[model samples]
Target: MDLKKLEEFILEVGAENIPLGMLTITNNSAAGQPVSMDNIRQTAEIYHSFGIPFFLDACRFSENAWFIKIRDPKYANTPVKDIVLEMCSYADGCTMSAKKDAIVNIGGFIAFRDPELKQKIAQNLIVHEGFLTYGGLSGRDLEAIAVGMHEAVDEDYLNYREAHTRYLGQVLTEAGLPVYMPTGGHAVYVDGGKALPHIPHSQFPAVALGNALYLAGGVRTVEIGSLMFEHVDPQTGEPVYAPLELLRFAIPRRVYTRSHLDYIGESAAICMKEAQAIRGLRVKWAPPVLRHFMAQLEEV
Candidate 1:
């Protein structure tokens, strides 16, 4: 969930007096640090103190479930499905990213306990998406999601993925590269703050790291910082907050093996050891008429 945006929305809705609630805070394992559950709870408690009904974005419930089990083995016997349902009870409604937790190629869903709100939301969905019969997803994709959701909790599968992440983290750490301890989900984070202390945030640390890694080892990585919003112009665009420059290395589940991870670690180490400063370059960007994905960029 975009908590910053959500908080702003809450303030706008005149619900500043009402309490907000969130299930759990987990990091964008794909990004870097875990989202703080304590922070979320405090925010929710504040809203609750004001007598407002709070809702959680529970799309990543499965990941949180895995985290809980791994972090506290005493709860290992708890069923993830049950945990998800229980967590949903705290929220007025939830928006789920079926694609991630459900492992389907394309699917999403929203759940609410309030019948009136549920009906209203469903009505809106029917107009924007398809009817409940179709649910804006293909039948095959739904099937995949169902199967994937079931497999998402398998201890063996989760263990393998977790081990792989740890292995990647260990390799990078041992190589004396700046890495976040306690890797999250299925990604390893290269701490841009520590990796490139000399680089300023305004200079796009994540982008610099990504480009450096690519040049040093031919490995592709994405920057989580300012580079993500490179299209925004200083004069015309709004300012961005949070760490915009994070170099993220996402490990695909059941895809890349240990050997592949080793190669990635080796590449990262070499990049850290040999990276050079990047000189600034400026270019103009035009907003896309259609999909930005389809838009082409060329040197002017």
Candidate 2:
């Protein structure tokens, strides 16, 4: 996170205008990059100083802890569980999608230090979801989450997972693809704009690159560029585009082998060789909000 930008924005907008402050641990939008421990603590301090509550979107907390262990020398020898605990200590609470770090197929949860807040959330949950005990999940699912949460913090498992992602990033880079530096915890992001310079931002280069990867080896990837972040400039009434066109290869946990990644790298290489022939796409239909989720498009 850009600390300067964040502080400047908060000051410019005025603390009274802000409702809540939340930080994503493994900032998924930025190639799953892990947030530093110092940054989290400082961010929480900033929010608390302004009388704003701070929360964490801690879905990949375990992976993030692992990154800190390997990247920051101060915590090089610290236990993953200890690192995780310290990370959470800086926030008032956290919301999680258990599917990511918890290693569950589905089901998520919210945790807070305040009992009053917990009661309020539970009351709402009872009205919309199920009872306080289960909260719409079966007992078995709850058990899985309980077990998965512990396994997620296992250093042996985390080491393997980090190495696994790095391997793919290395292969992609060696294959002449412009892969993002310092491979992230969960996924490898390629600079689609660099690969498909022929396709402009207006044409959704990231989407075209994703399509090319799919066609090359049946490998699926998500576009994290204009298609995902495009918006209108309210002041000028002009469309705004993302600065970087990126394609995210979000590898599923405990799935696929090195061979699979090799095939993906080869597929990307093929796309690079024939990148000039790739055509850009034009949106045909879209929703008013989050158009990328279900937008219809055709080659332009």
The model with the greatest TM-score is: 2
Give the TM-score comparing model 1 with the true structure, all chains together. Answer: 0.76
Question: What is candidate 1's lDDT per residue for 1-300, written digit by digit as tens?
Answer: 465676676677777544445443345634534434444455556556556766766555666666766565655678766655555555566676776656666777776777997788778888899887568888888788778878877767777777888898898787666776678775777777567777666555656676667776787776565534444447969655335356678776677888887887787778777655543222235345432223222321
User: lDDT tens string, model 2, 73-158?
Assistant: 99999999999999999888999999999999999899988899899999999999898888999999999999999999999989
Residue ranges of candidate 1 with Cα displaced over 4 Å? 1-25, 29-51, 73-77, 215-218, 228-244, 277-300
On the 0 to 100 scale, the lDDT of residue 276 in model 1 is 51
Each candidate structure's TM-score, on Cα atoms with residue i matched to residue i, is 0.76, 0.97
Residue 103: error of model 2 in Å?
0.8
Best by lDDT: 2
